[model samples]
Target: MLSTSGTIIGIDSSTGACSIAVCRGGTMLAHFHEDMTRGQSERLAPMAEAGLAAAGLGFPDLDAIAVTRGPGSFTGLRIGMAFAKGLGQALGIPVFGVTGFDAVARAVFATEAAAGHGIAVILESRRADLFLQIYTTGGAPDGPPVALPPEDIAARLCQEGAAPLLLAGDAADKVLAVLDQASAAMLRSSLITAPDAREVALIGLEMAGDGDIPPALQPLYLRAPDVTAPRAG
Candidate 1:
């Protein structure tokens, strides 16, 4: 368990956006987010500096670091994890890893809109398939997240049930398109949403307080990257 009342900085560059937040005692002191498909490596540190400045705090004041350990953009995930680990190492502070699923699901669980609805989180893979996880109305994961074609995902959700469902994440619409008309008709969506660092901080604090921090924060890549091998020498 954490010794202090928790002053932490959360960083997320797991999707198209780069975001950072500073929270002390479970309240956000400052946050910054910008949507960009690239340039997180160049911009993340300056943005962290800005968040610290806006919060009227400095690096020495932080008790821990929290970051999204992703099933997200491969490049984006590395940018965030590297920044958080480097800073934590330099400052001698523990770093906590929160999943991309929990980061976005936290927002949905807090809203009244989520009542009476199962949640299906669909993350973009920048490929033909997508990353998906389902949650009960009360916010427990139905199973592990997986990368699957839209049709397969639709089939799985149908097996789960056809109750009113809420679809979330950047790729919600693509899943909506592939669902059977019955499932499609009972759905609501929050397509503009992406994982935000503000929630990352809160979730991290909860994880730490419960002594759930991992020994190592590894990237939660749902599938391998789409890299091409170089030509033979």
Candidate 2:
């Protein structure tokens, strides 16, 4: 029984950046974002508290919590999920999970930026491969998200034919670098390089308005974490 009219705080620590936004009735009341490759665990809670303070609210004032579910840094995703769920449980409210792709795509479509162009979301994976997804001009996903190297992503875009395309996400530059001049000619860069918690909040509000129960929160891992095993001492 979620309601958009109630206060909501959206959290996103799924990328190099971590952000939180407080919104009421679909309008943002406060937002705080910081760019960092690590330390999300330390910064997220304080940022969330700051957002609530700026909005003149407290934990008890929040009606629900919204958080990005990932396709991002493994540790960052876990930190965000745990924070949102813990807060929700303590407050006796629901926690909604939104994918990083959906958060960015919804923001893009809202601005009408992809009106006549295809969209390729190029999220950084911090590895040789990246999390990628394509979308039609109409804002529908062209296909499922996949983990691919920059070269393969460029090849896939080329194979889609020369419809003007918009390249988004934090890794757009990485993908753009590998595209040849001809392919590059048809592509445009979106201003949204990272998923913002403000957008996460709006999307969450929409989810609440839809009147369906929110799915469980889980990290959207596109690839296994890159870890090295220690040799026996």
Candidate 3:
């Protein structure tokens, strides 16, 4: 008989999407999601509580807490990390970090294959740039994520070889405009706007089950914060 590994909570408050999930081993038991334009601090914890309740568990019953570590909205990232850290510390359980991009990529790949080309997941950064990454159909990273000016991303896509690409994430609509023009004649595209917390939870549980927990869980901030104070003239 397989021994139970207890429950895990996956929290993702990245982009405009916020979600919580409960899982055991690699199976997701319950999930909650919301499209919050503001107030993640207010919603995340309650959502987590609800998800745990739905799974018939509580914070004390969780074996681990997993969260999306950035390359996303700074406020959202901080809220998620803080909540996970506090919960884990209180319960004396381990807390792990997964990338926001990777979480969305996993959800997309779980649904389809990148048979002809590659996949790109884009998340809107409140700046003039977009957060983007390319991945193989099997969820392997093709390259590091970059915060690029919208036009530059379009140019790059046009230059890449003709392969059917799948696009998804919080910034799907904005990214689609450029991608559509770039790959207008050759590439095919599909969009999934939100990342699934259930998928994130399952992936996190799998990693934890494999003893792949890293000591430091940090968010993937691709660029400096937009609010830099100008030097005095």
Candidate 4:
């Protein structure tokens, strides 16, 4: 492992936001967050530059980079990954990839450690379905990520047993609405709406300390792109 004093940077543009964070050891040095479902490709670099400037660091000074590789918007994931990998390659530093699901789950796990119940990190797919994953209290995933219809979430959680469900990510409210009042009572809303770069920084720090290398930086897609070429007009 590099010196604990080295700085780590994390990025999240896997959904509607472009977020950048700089951290040292286990503490956040700086972060920039903004929501723009479009134009992430344009905003990412400037945001990274400004965030680092705010933190009084530069790209060359960066020790590692963490970017969310997701089961969210395809274009958004592509933009984020391209920028992060380019930066990491240029700086010759390790680029860590964190999943959107795990980012939210890990954040909630930190805040609600007493919740032996479990956390569901749901990413809104802008359809009747959602990109979802469940994490036990210890922060390890209970299962692999899957694309699930929002209507099925409540029943699916029930299938997992009676552990209280802590719902997080931007689509939490939709999942709650699908449940009956009694079942809804079993769910507790998490403070995070979407996974933020601040949490990503802390996560990167933990991975670094534990000497765990995250997955390779790439777009993690749950579904095919909505666009396709028209044939034979």
Candidate 5:
């Protein structure tokens, strides 16, 4: 089991970004990010090694590993999870899973301007739907994550009666057109486009402290997979 002050590493390759971070006692020691629409598998390992190197650590030094468990690119998620699990297995450390919403909410709460505001993390699917979740002002998630269309997302938040809502994720802008004047006024969007591995590390630290780590790492596929395997001979 990871101690409260244990060192943790977070990895996220679940979107356009491939990120890695090392954290100790809730503080991020080092992190690396590469922005690419694809090819995360090629970069994730070196990035992870670099982050560990930057932190003056090695795989065996980690007490736990955390990773964004999906609701983003299918290939990206698989690549990240595999790397994280491999590290955990090799180093004999625990591996935990985090959601995109958890990362976004942690990042939002990390901002001073977002203090005391509810949050809605909206990750866009390649299809017409979105992956959504809510967190209260203090960064505690309110409920389970769900999927909805852009219009329904706007309407649902309105029904939830969350005022001064802090919005993050790439598809946040799409929900704006469908929001009523009152709903729009009730919400405030942030600059975060997608979840970051640093935030994943931060939240992972908390989860480690609180002993809230997941039993297993699994992809949070809000929708069906976007890719189909090519026919083999």
Candidate 6:
């Protein structure tokens, strides 16, 4: 739970998806999310306002703001960070950045038991690559995230020597085909997709309470943005 009595807001415009949530003392009071491919800049502010309204609060009542740092769409991360910064500054509150994977992991770990193979979160990164991370069932890291080709990820999973693996996040479907063939006998994977805004709020609350907020709250771009300048002539 947050150490203070004020409200906290969490934003995640880190993929094609967008979400905003408000919480009081680690309990989510309201949230909004959309799986749209565009229009985040226009949608985010209203969503934030709606969340605050649902919580019977306003921007001035907030104590902190949280946002997904990334390993996601470049444009989406920028938009979310900019919004969080603006709102935090205007409200005189702190802004914290949480990774998309960490948010999802927190969400999953809250409801599930910690006795399975592990949790694998895969979010689409626009190209053929994916943003992938492995976490123990207890929300501890098995390894850091890596951007890997679908086949390579499947191959590695086949070699992991684990069973009953749980898979979640936006890109689970795309990875399923590859994983099915690669690890058919050795591993089992489930596709469960949903972003729990409440879970995000809870995690943000804990971070705020702990005073572990980042200095800048930038996006966690795991790989370089897809677009790069052309070579000098």
Order the numbered candidates by lDDT, best leading.
2, 1, 5, 4, 3, 6
TM-score of each: 0.94, 0.93, 0.87, 0.92, 0.91, 0.87
Q: Write the per-residue lDDT of candidate 3 for residues 77-101, one digit (tens) a residue.
A: 8998999899989998888788878
Compose the digit string of candidate 4's lDDT tens values, residues 38-85. Answer: 999989999999988999888888988888888788888888888889
For candidate 5, write residues 1-233 as lDDT tens digits: 46768999989999988999999986789989889989998998888888889999987888888899978998899999999889888887778898888888778777886887888899978788888998887777778888899988988788754656788888899898788787788788989889899988877777777766468888899778756799999
User: Which pairs clash in model 4?
Assistant: none
Shift in Å, residue 233, candidate 5: 12
lDDT tens digits, residues 55-163, model 2? 9999899888889998998889999999999998999888889889988887777777778887888898878998998888877788789999999998888875556
Clash list (residue pairs), candidate 2: none
Q: Which regions of candidate 4 fall more than 4 Å away from where they truly are? A: 112-114, 212-215
Candidate 3 to truth, TM? 0.87
lDDT of 3 at 196: 55
Show model 3 residue runs off by greater than 4 Å. 1-5, 113-116, 160-162, 179-182, 228-233
Per-model CA lDDT versus the true structure: 0.87, 0.87, 0.76, 0.81, 0.85, 0.75
Tell how far residue 70 is off in model 4, in angstroms: 0.3
When summed lDDT is taken over every stretch of 10 residues in candidate 2, the lowest stretch is: 156-165
- What global local distance difference test value does model 3 have? 0.76
Where model 1 places Cα greater than 4 Å from the true spot, the runs are 160-163
Q: Local error of candidate 2 at 221, Å?
A: 0.7
Q: Report the C-alpha lDDT of model 6 over 108-128, residue by residue, as the tens digit.
A: 665544355577888888788
Candidate 4 lDDT score at position 101: 85
Model 2, C-alpha of 34: deviation from truth (Å): 1.4
Worst 10 residues of 6 by lDDT: 187-196
